[model samples]
Target: MSRRVRLALLTPALLGLGGLFAWAIAGLPEFGDYRGPYGYVLNQIVVPLRHSTNVVMGTTFDVRGLDTMGEEFILYAAVVGVTLLLRDESGAGRVERRTRRARSDTVRLLGVLMIGVGLLVGLWLVAFGYITPGGGFPGGVVLAGAIVVLYLVGSHRDYGPFRNEHALDPFEGLGAGGYVITGLAALALGLQFLTNLFGYGKAGTLLSAGSIGILNAASGIAVTVAMLLLFAEFLETYVVPLEPEDVGS
Candidate 1:
């Protein structure tokens, strides 16, 4: 069978299955009562746990932390694969100095300022993720955006002094390890996996949500470092190729 034929058949089959499921659900109770134990749990426990309108976000970082760990690992693996595939070849010659573009000093200064502010805000978001609306993943992305802004404005030579890439692996490793340890601590206490071992604290305090806060912090650190490392590595491998012209040929 041709690929087109297979896809045509598959599409109809999926549509048929979807229709069947819809019909089956349509036949179920229309006016249900929330009185049972399961219903009570749903009302009291499950609903309260989801603090965000973003369903996937709430589930990944809050309700299903273990699963989120696996998801993070998947992302990490993808980054590693990209790094490997895009690495500079051994045969590639060293980069030589070249007449570089004249970067705008004003823009560079603004980028540095933005980087400083973004870093502080991102850190706050990560640290207070459990208490507030923001989270580690979002915070990490914010930091990455700051890095991009810095790169866009600064001279390529400026990145060399930063060594942001070198710091990433160790920091990420620490964050992952911290998350795992936090989980294990909960388990050791005879609580469920990734349980909120620490007090939820005051409803509005920075210390609210206990272990969840710690987990968010770990995740934030990991994601930030990983993204920065990946971006820097990508630039080195693909955009900044190891050609003599790249340096000074």
Candidate 2:
């Protein structure tokens, strides 16, 4: 289309989106102070009905599970597209470039500490997702952050051991596939898709949210893998030399 015509069509759409976004933001409660009826109701009922202390997780992984599945696949589809379009172009197996490594002891020490903290926090988020504020999504990103720390601190040679598709691909597959299998299993049992099938253990415990917690952990894995894979794809020329097997795959 002509530039004028494109602008004419885009202008109204942009205005409409901006207006809606403003409206939504304006309606949000101030931080640390929420009194919405939905929140109140969820606070009361989530633990009793879903046996999950985190109402957000109960809503996401159980009550609105099918929707969450759709969201997870959205990431899956996006990652697949990135892999297909960019993986071939990376050519990490065919070429190697001079790499830069951190030389400062102070920087390395700080990065190592951050990596440790990120790992601990990420695992904690997934472990207590149903009982606390965080869930799979945030936890996955934190884990990815740890990987990023290792990358930032290590020499290209130092990162060699951890920088391959084989090291990262399995988590992506299991995470994406696990979510679907759980839902399908529910169908096999004639229960609602993504139903909370596993027994709800005592609330406020690690095992409390049943399928909800499982889904959260799976999501964390998928997200962590997805993000790391993206990093690998983009940093192929910067990362360690890929193995001969990687070139064929």
Candidate 3:
């Protein structure tokens, strides 16, 4: 329809959403209110139950894992939608073109160095997510950022492991699927879905939080692969003109 009509409709919708948000916010306890019931439960119930020192991680990947699963599926759906909508179906192969501006050797060397460091740090965060402040989400972002650095330095193609788009595609699915499988396995064992089914080890150690560690690693993999896939798609985008015969058909 007309732009004016669209704007009129959108204005009320925005206002309605804002009103609902404000109403919800108004119901929240005052800032710095430790006397709130939610805080007490978080400190006493959730943290001890998960055996996790990182309260945020415990809440996200364990206490509210079902909610997190919904969020993950939304992200997965968005990536799939983007891929389908932007699919290259013109049948013309990718056109090669040289960059107008070249990066300096120093930048390239730095990218190589950072890639190793990023990978190490990302894995460390995922592995230690149970005990530490950082988790899979941030670690995954770091890993993706490292790949982006490689792209900036024009070394994406030279990286053999991440070079193949098809190969990387499965990782997104695998990571997400692994998470669901873990939950389902718990269900099969008569435990609640996404429950901390495994034994909680020494509270402060790496292997302490049982399934939280697995979930964190899974989340890291999923986020890293999804981000990389999106980057590859946007980078290699090209337009193909339709042939006259095909257009007519």
Cα lDDT for residue 178, candidate 1: 81
lDDT of 3 by residue, 51-96 (tens): 7888788888888999878777877887788788767799456764
What digit string (tens of lDDT, one per residue) describes model 1 on residues 30-66?
Answer: 6674345753544355325543333334455657889
List runs of model 1 lying over 4 Å from the truth: 1-59, 89-102, 161-165, 239-249
Which sections of candidate 2 miss by over 4 Å? 1-38, 89-93, 237-249
Q: TM-score per candidate, in order? A: 0.70, 0.79, 0.80
lDDT of 1 at 188: 94
lDDT on C-alpha atoms for all candidate structures? 0.69, 0.83, 0.78
Model 1's lDDT to the true fold?
0.69
Global lDDT of model 2:
0.83
Q: Candidate 2: which pairs clash?
A: none
Give the candidate order by descending TM-score: 3, 2, 1
Per-residue CA lDDT of model 2 for 36-62, tens digit only, reads: 688788778889987898899889888
